[model samples]
Target: MKQIIEKKRTLGLLLVILGASFWGIGGTVAQRLFQQDNIAVEWLVSSRLLLAGILLIALYKITHRQASIFVIWRTKQTAFRQILFSLLGMLAVQYTYMMSIAIGNSAVATLLQYLAPLFIMAYYLLTRHSALTRQDGIAVTLTLVGTFLLLTNGSFSTLSVPFMAVFWGILSGLSLAFYSIYAVPLLQQFHSLLVVGWSMLIGGTVMSFFHQPWLIDLSTWTFSTVLYYLFIIIFGTMLAFWFYIASLRYLSPKEASLLGSLEPLTAVITSVWWLKISFGGYQFMGTLLILLMILYLTVFQKKQRER
Candidate 1:
């Protein structure tokens, strides 16, 4: 039984890492589309959310015909909470992260969003009044130093990007933090598919009023651009959510979110490897620091379980 549990958890962690990988790569691709094609951010966000939401919901309808997505919101209390989460957490995260990408580049946007774990840490401390462990303190310090190195590119005299990127990126981080913490109750009680699908649908529907994605013009887009857009919607948005949500079954929301540190590492590698962006020792060290923090958390959790 113990071995079986371990195997299941390993599977869950891999799925969450895969999901984060998609987000990282997808963000890079989306950044390319935005910069090269001048694609409208509002339209892309609205379309991605709606299309991904619909696809997941349709999948649920097919497999579990007995369980409607509406069952997630069967009670008034739940309905209200779900709507609030959809708007405040889901919608905000999607839009702000995309906006950060549009205003900046993927690596910076992604790294900034990793600040979500910090917010998660602060939240657990404040609400739970939990005392910090030695590992937590060291991890927090590493995360901060890693973030600073990334943004400054190891330089004290200059920032690597404009102020707008920093502003929007921090907002993206906050939104991500909120979603990771807030989605716990719903995720624990329902199928990950049901909760995520309905939340996406509701969030997309709300964003539609502000930006009518159907009115988008694709005349300037080529075959490759179209392919990238589809990939973002299907793989990055839809599959990513499904995998990450499913991981909640095996891991605490905070630990799962902490494991998401992999996304920025993925983004940085993609940026340098595929995009031919320049990189060097300092960035590598920063990446190492962040990875060490993740490693610390993983070991800490396992050790606690053993104890």
Candidate 2:
């Protein structure tokens, strides 16, 4: 039993790490397409969500042949909730993250999205009127200081990242907070595959009405561009979400979330090392501070739970 559990845990760790890395690298690749191939964010996002959603649903069908995929829509309440989540949570997160990458490099865009926890904390404080714990205070402080340094690059007189990128990045974090919080009940009740697949499909369908991703021009697409596009839909969107959700079977949410820091770290490394994007000293410190905030919160929460 112990050996089996250990093996499962190891598998979970690998799955999550791979998922996070794929997501991070996907951002960088999307950045390449956006800058080099001039792929519009609207078309890429809509197509990714639509195609990945179909593939994920197909995967769920193949794996759970006896299960019903339409169970989420059995109840009117659940149906409404799922549709709400599809638009507000899934679509919002996808669009904002891509916009941030379109306007800025993936490193900065990903780091900004890591601020989701801070927004989640703030949401609880506002909604529940919960008193801010000392640890929460410290985490918030670290996030604020880190964000300031990251944007300003230690110089208040100038912003290292563009104003619009920061705006979209901040929105991505906010949407991520909502996405994480709102999906909890549905995820607990249904298979992650079902929930995610439907959300993506619904969201993509809605976005298609406006963006018309099918109308996108493919006349200029080269072999590399097609490969990048496929990578984003398959490895990045589909497998990344699948692996992360599957990891939850063996690892606790806290453990998985801690491992998720690798996403931003991967983005930073790929952006700098592979993409040759500049990383200044102040930006590094800011990144460290943001990561420290996450570690501090996780450690503090664990200790509190133990006590």
Candidate 3:
């Protein structure tokens, strides 16, 4: 029975990692589309969230065959908290990431974003929780090193880290950490889809106020642009979030954290294939180190459990 449970948990973690990998693909796609089309970043984010929220909500209703839409307005307190999480987690992180990219480069932005796990570890520590074990430390170190190499192009000194970019990236990381931590509690109280849907809706709605998506020139929407938007909404936001939440049901937070490191790796692969970006030998090695760290942590964790 214990073995069976462990197997199930492993499967769940795999699913979550797979979901995050798919989610990682969105950045490359977005960047490619953005370069080709004259689309504002704000508008792109706003549209993606709004469309994704609508689609997920619809999916939830169709699957359950119930009126979940009305649940959104059941209570002001619930509504407000949902919106708050959405803004802080989804909107804030997304916008901050974009801003970081603008201020620095994709590599820097990605490294900073991947630092969420570290921030999470720190959060736990601050709360008087046990510090991450050797495995966790190894995993975090490996990820950080991998991120640095991935971003620095193998020579840290060659790169000039922009202060603003770093700030935004750190902020993005914290936002994501907070989202993960806080979301766990919310998920316990509400269905994952419902919580996700409401959060997306609230986040999307708040972003719309600032982005004024209506101001976007509809004439700019081309066949390719529409396709790009569709991919972001469907694959990036909706499917990714769904899979991530599903994974949480079976995986420990530590396990999930380790798997989440794959995002940067996926991003790198996408960059190479989709974005036509290339890296040098050292850069590749750095990425490898990061992966190794994640593997070390995960395998060590399994070993510990067995003992």
Candidate 4:
């Protein structure tokens, strides 16, 4: 039984890692479409949330015959809560991340999103929950230093990327922190996929009023861009959420969040390898430092749990 429990935890960690990695790769692909093809961010975000939500809900209905999607939001209070979740948590995170990508490269955008952990740390303290440990303090410092180095390439005078990328990226990080924290109770009660699906549906419906994706010129779409859209929706948005939520079954959101450090690393690697993005020695060091945060949590936390 003990070994079985450990096995489940291991699987959970691996799933979160895989999910984050997919997110990173998907961000790179989305960056390509935005940079090369000039695909509109609003359109993709609108379409992704709408379609992915529908598909996930459909999947839930198929697999869960006895379970109805409506039950999760049946009560007025829960419905209100879910609506807020959809707007502030779901829509905010998705839109901001995509906007960040549109303004900057995938590597920078994704790494900035990893800053969610720092926000989460502050949140925990303010809520008077688990206090930050020495290790957590180290993680925070490394993340800040790493982000500065990666963004500036050790230059204090000028910014390497557009200023809006930093703005949108930081907004994405805060939204992600909010989303992850808000998701816990819902995951504990309902099907994770169902919750995610409904939230996406709600958020997409709201954003569509403003973005109007249907009005966009689809005539400009080519085979490669279409393929990229499929990947962004299917692998990136759908499967990534499914796997990440499944991992929450065996881990806290904070633990899952920490594991998500894989995202920036994967993003950096793919951006450099396929996209020909350049990085300085300082940026490389910064990237390594960020990766060390992942190693620290994975190695050190396990021992803490065992003790």
TM-score of 2: 0.80
Candidate 1, run of 10 with poorest lDDT: 150-159
Compute the lDDT for candidate 1: 0.79
Which candidate order results from sorting by lDDT in descending order?
4, 1, 2, 3
Model 2 Cα shift for residue 261 (angstroms): 4.8
Alpha-carbon shift of residue 61 in model 4 (angstroms): 1.8
State which candidate, 3 or 4, has the greater lDDT. 4
What shift in Å separates residue 234 of candidate 4 from its native position after superposition? Answer: 0.8
lDDT of 2 at 1: 73
Q: How well does candidate 2 score on lDDT at residue 51?
A: 99
Cα displacement (angstroms), candidate 3, residue 229, comes to: 1.9
Sliding window of 10 residues with minimal summed lDDT for model 4: 151-160
lDDT of 4 at 223: 94
Q: On residues 1-307, what C-alpha lDDT tens digit does candidate 1 reach at each position?
A: 8788777788778888898888878877887888898888998888888989898889988999887677876798778877887888878888888877677655567677878877888888899856667767787678767755654468755446678987888998898888877777887777777777878888888889999988877799899999999999988889887788788777766667777766666766887898898776777888888778777776666777787
lDDT of 3 by residue, 38-138 (tens): 66778877877787877877778888885566574588876677777788877787788878877787777887887788888888888967676776777
Show where candidate 1 strays beyond 4 Å: 104-108, 147-152, 156-164
lDDT string, candidate 2, 22-140, tens digits: 98788778888988998989998999999999989998999999999899999998999999988888899889988887777564676677677677767777888465678656766
Name the candidate, 1 or 4, with the larger lDDT value.
4
How would you encode candidate 4's per-residue C-alpha lDDT over 73-188 as one tens digit per residue?
A: 68887777778888988889999988887777555676678788878988989999889889778867776677657655787654457999989988998998888788777777
